[model samples]
Target: MEIITINYPLQGLEDKGPIRPKTLAIGHFDGVHKGHQSVIRRAVDVARAEGLEAAVMTFHPHPKEVLGRGSEYTTCLTPLEDKLERFRSLRVDIVYVVTFNLTFAAVSPAAFVDEMLRPLQVKRAVVGFDFSFGAKGAGRAETLRELAGSDMKVDIIEPLMMDGDKVSSTLVREALAGGRPETAEQLLGVPFSLRGTVVKGEGRGRTIGYPTANIQLAGAYVTPRLGVYAVMAELSDGERYSGVLNVGVKPTFHDSLPMPVMEVHLFDYEGDLYGSTVRISFISFLRSEKKFASVQELIEQIGADALKARSVLSAFK
Candidate 1:
């Protein structure tokens, strides 16, 4: 899929007049969970039936982060690279990441359709049932149809629901924050994962005979509850390994520092994983973070965690 970063300096839609007459799916697509999958699937269907290319239009920096429009939410479900990869996996022909700036946000609904959608030559547009666009969100599905007139087709895909409630990114974030891994997995249609490059640590885990891969998170990434978790780690080479991760400070050492950290000890494996990117998929919460009486007690508990992690990941393997 073609990934295009759109900005004011570019020619906007006119730069790609040749790519018009495309089937477009529009949304912020924060998590690109099951609900978003539904919208993209419909867009692909429309593109196939209408004999046009499929594209996804999304806002970057989130409208909220750019314009300070609404209540601030936690980080994102997927980072830029991961989000684009998801769209490519869905077989989207193009991904248009529009920079959300004040000038762009000020564009009215009609002007947006004329300047952006029309210029893209959108033959058909797909959006969530509650989707809204343009300045102040003045444009709804009904308004979009009116603006398009008879020149384009608009498909308002219905909201995807589970247990009688709409599946949304906000709910997924809440679930993860609350340590409800099962619920987040249901919405994501996959395990909740964190990807980052392994970095050097204090070598404390090494001294304890359980050397771990320390990971660094991006600024806009959201972490789960501070505790121990049974997780599956995917190495850069695509190999999967089960492990126990500690997501908190070294309380066992009597350290008062409150730096949140992630340290994963891979089971039955040994190698130089430092400097390599690893993706950890959370399976289940094991226990809450606690201060142990001594290094001996902490070691004993870690042994138990390894045993439990092995049991849980056995089925996954």
Candidate 2:
């Protein structure tokens, strides 16, 4: 997929070249969960039927972060790079990453449709039922359709439900934050995962006979609750291993730490992983993090956690 970054005023977008008319699936698409997949798939199918290119439009830095809303309150499901990779996997033909700033945010609904959508040759637009656009979110799907007039078609996908709850990024975030990865997976149609580079640690896990790969997260992703979890770790070369992962401050070893760390002990694997990137997919929650009086007690509990993690991950295999 071709990724194009656009700022406000959208200069040279049309002058660069003329392309096929686009059927755009537009949304924040944070997690790109099952609900988002449905919307994108629909746009792809429509694009194929109408002989148009399938495109996805996403915003950057999140509007909330730029508009005086607290950045800490907004935890991203996937970073921009990961989100674009997801879009590529969905076979989108084009991706427009719009820079969200005060100037762009102030674009009127009519101007948005006339200047942006028209210049891009958009024949159809697909968005979720709750989607809103334009300054102050003054435009709705119906309003967009009206603005586009007879030249463009609008599609509003109804809410997708799973386990009696609407499948949404907010629900997925809540599940992960609450240490319910399995529930988040059900909503996402895939395991909730974290990608990070293996960094050097304090070597405490090795001293305890359970060597761990300390991970440095690449982006501002939502962190799961502090706990031990059953996980599957995939190395850079595509080899995957079942593991037990800890997300905590290592209270047993230190009084306090500035930040929580992610450490994963791969079952039956022995090799240097430092400096390599790995993806950890959370499967199930095992136990919450807690302080232990002695290192031996922590090791004993970790042994139990490993056994339970192996049992859970076996089902996945």
Measured over all alpha carbons after superposition, the RMSD of each candidate to the real structure, in angstroms, is 1.9, 1.3
Predicted candidate 1 versus true structure: per-residue lDDT over 71-133, tens digit per residue: 544477887777887898899999999998898888889888888887777888888988888
Deviation (Å) of 126 in candidate 2: 0.4
Model 2 C-alpha lDDT per residue in residues 1-317, reported as the tens digit of each score: 89999887878676557767899998889889999999999999999887889999999978877776765536688889889989999999999999999998899999988878888888999999888899999998888988989989999999999879899988998899899998999888889887999999999889889999999998888989999999999999999999999999999888999989999999999899999999999999999999999888999999999999999999766
Compared to the true structure, candidate 1 yields what TM-score? 0.94
State residue 294's C-alpha deviation in candidate 1, in Å: 1.3
Best by TM-score: 2
Worst window of 10 by summed lDDT in candidate 2: 66-75
Whole-model alpha-carbon lDDT for candidate 2: 0.91
Model 2 vs. true fold: TM:
0.97
Q: For model 1, what is the C-alpha lDDT against the true structure?
A: 0.86
